[model samples]
Target: MLAESIVIIGVNHKTAPVAVREKLAFSGDCAGPLLTLMDIDGCRECCFLSTCNRVEVIFVASDPAVAAVAVRGFLFAKSGLGDAEAQQYSYLYQGKEAVAHLYNVAASLDSMVVGEPQILGQLKQAYRDAVEQKTTGVILNRLLHKSFSVAKRVRTETNIGGSAVSISYAAVQLAKKIFGSLQDKAVLLVGAGEMAELAAEHLVRQGIGRVIVANRTLERAAKLARKFNGTAVGLAELTTQLAEVDILVSSTGATDLILRKDEVKPLMRQRKNRPLFLIDIAVPRDLDPEINDLDNVYLYDIDDLKNVVDVNKAEREKEALRAEGIVAEEVVKFGLWLEGMELAPTITAIRQKANAIREVEVAKTLGIMKSLTENERRSVEMLANAIVNKLLHEPMIFLKNSTPHDNPQLKLAFIRQMFGLDKESPEQQPPRENV
Candidate 1:
């Protein structure tokens, strides 16, 4: 039988703040556990996407309502948010709507700053994480691969991602605004993750001198340090290196602040207040919120970067109408496919039921007319087959054209029960029409 399958739940910048988002963020280490949790009962396939701006759980389930509720409860419990808070901010989508949402997200249409390119990479990482954990099955694999293709199509065919509107790029721009030139600035990258790498690359492109990468894992830190030809140090010594660094960009996954106000206060004294610029891109935030109060320490959190992102967002919104039109076109095409899937089994059963009845009637007539010529029996059989095909032609066409709005599945089920085709028949035949 054809089954209803699709993504059920998601949460992003639109639904939650960075603090709330970070609490639900799934790390590489947590992928296995999260996948295990999603595999319980109703969930069929799963992928967890975690980035600075979003923490979404994508799944294909037999029951979307049950799956959505379970996912929402899990997120709220893990994030320590009240049920009311989750209900207030969280959004739920099912079936074709959910698929459309994911396509836009992967295509960067729903990004905080539309057409920002980093989201595609973040989605790729999420897919990889799911694959590594062995949680994503056939449905999720196909969905993600198709989503990637759709994103590529939108980027290549349209002017959406043609410009850079990402916060990382904006951070670089903001840095330039503060300091006339970045040529002699020292940049400290406090995490070896993708975000830090992106910001560090952007800073280096602007001729920044001496990049440093610090992380809890020395090997990972060294790998990134080597890529930029910079120094790598244990995160424990981050406070000591703070004084010498001119620009600090921290995106560690640590649950607490790496650079508290007290820690940065002494560093300010040592640098003689050399105007340290700190960008806290992490969810829980690598730098303390209180650090903004310290003299000479300028701190910019995820929200602080919004002003820069908003300027880009406004420009992109003009092109968004065009992009949204593209998404709508694609969504309708997908919806048709989903509708066709619903009719598939019913159509198969109908053909089977008709063919079985025709065969039985043909055999009974042949047995009763054993004295008739062979040509006569052959003609009767052919006539019966033609009659069955003619009788089913219109219903088959109707099934193919039906939409979800018409409750295609319920209609198909009713047809199956009415024709006594709900149960399998020994003389079943394959569906003649290709879906």
Candidate 2:
């Protein structure tokens, strides 16, 4: 029943736009928000996760509805949104659904780019912060750890992350196919924007020998180039730079083509027509499409890269379905554990009570028959144990059944009251649940 107390409240890319997400996203260490969550009444255990695409609070609460409302308010504290608007833009999951949501997020099935690996690391960091703050207790500790293992299983058991799923990544994959190896290759990144920056990063990781960043403003070009320990050149140097690099990734905001076919045609002659790979990831098309017609010059635009992503995305979706199956299986396993937790206290109470009574009755009998031998006393004690075991057997089976047709909470309550377990000691009383 404690598992039924688990709650997750947050806004993700699906539920809220970027403007709202940025306003509500937490930055820096999670200590502040984690401590705040622990401060909320009935919030027993908690962890906080905030990334570029999502910000979520996962907590177990004795009062789930009230705690959820408080958490939603805390999340929207800086968003300039009223409670009604906040609720409209955010989502909440409780009990089993909350567990499933976390597992999905850990496995990256809920990611903006479904197989992206950054989110898992982000979640781990969030968990570490919670642990350091001492905000997580038994329930959250097991749940978060289980989520991590589920993510690992998904990664190992499926091909979810084995292919390119982004435009920048697809561009690098195409270049790899063309060049066979990028270890000795040089890349020229045109336009120092996010896409170009990402492509440059991917190529550098592939051991591209050199990187050249070219943009209209030399300052932005130099900034992006410095990140890869590469060279920076002005747009004026495109032709000269084009002759040197083996690959060109152009993603500029220019209204017209930044690199025309005529401009690149002559560059091919300068390099003795060494094979060139060109990728235009810009919206308005920075590189001319006709550049592909040039001998040994391969050009792919945004749509070309998208086609690659689409194919890979289909593969990831198939893998994701398998990942979902894994999550469902894990959820049921965790539910069984929670159910055992539900049954444990009452069972322990019943056994302890029965043993106490058996010991007293056996000792009294031995005291009354003072003439009995030691072996006779042992026989009497053993008979007392047998009777206690036989009396408790049926009740234990009743508690363990836990069928869908049964009400476990009612059964536990009935057993505790019938045995007078609650009246015996306050410490031994089972924890109260709303249900």
- TM-scores of the models, in the order given: 0.50, 0.69
lDDT by residue for model 1 (1-435), tens: 222467546678887777777777566665765666566667867888777777678887777767777777876668777776887768876777877888899999988878878899989988887888877775577568768877876776677765447788888887887886998889989988898999999999998989999999999999999999999999888888888888999998998877788878888888997898999999987788899998767899988886767767676777777777777777776665445445565687688779889989999999899998989889999999999999888877876786657745456655655677534235334358542
Per-prediction backbone clash count = 0, 0
What does the lDDT read for residue 409 in candidate 2? 54
lDDT string, candidate 2, 134-199, tens digits: 888767877898899889888878999979988888888888888888999999988999888888
Off by over 4 Å in 1: 1-5, 166-200, 203-315, 343-435
Model 2 poorest 10 in a row by lDDT: 422-431
* Cα lDDT, model 1, residue 32: 65
Q: How many backbone clashes does candidate 1 have?
A: 0
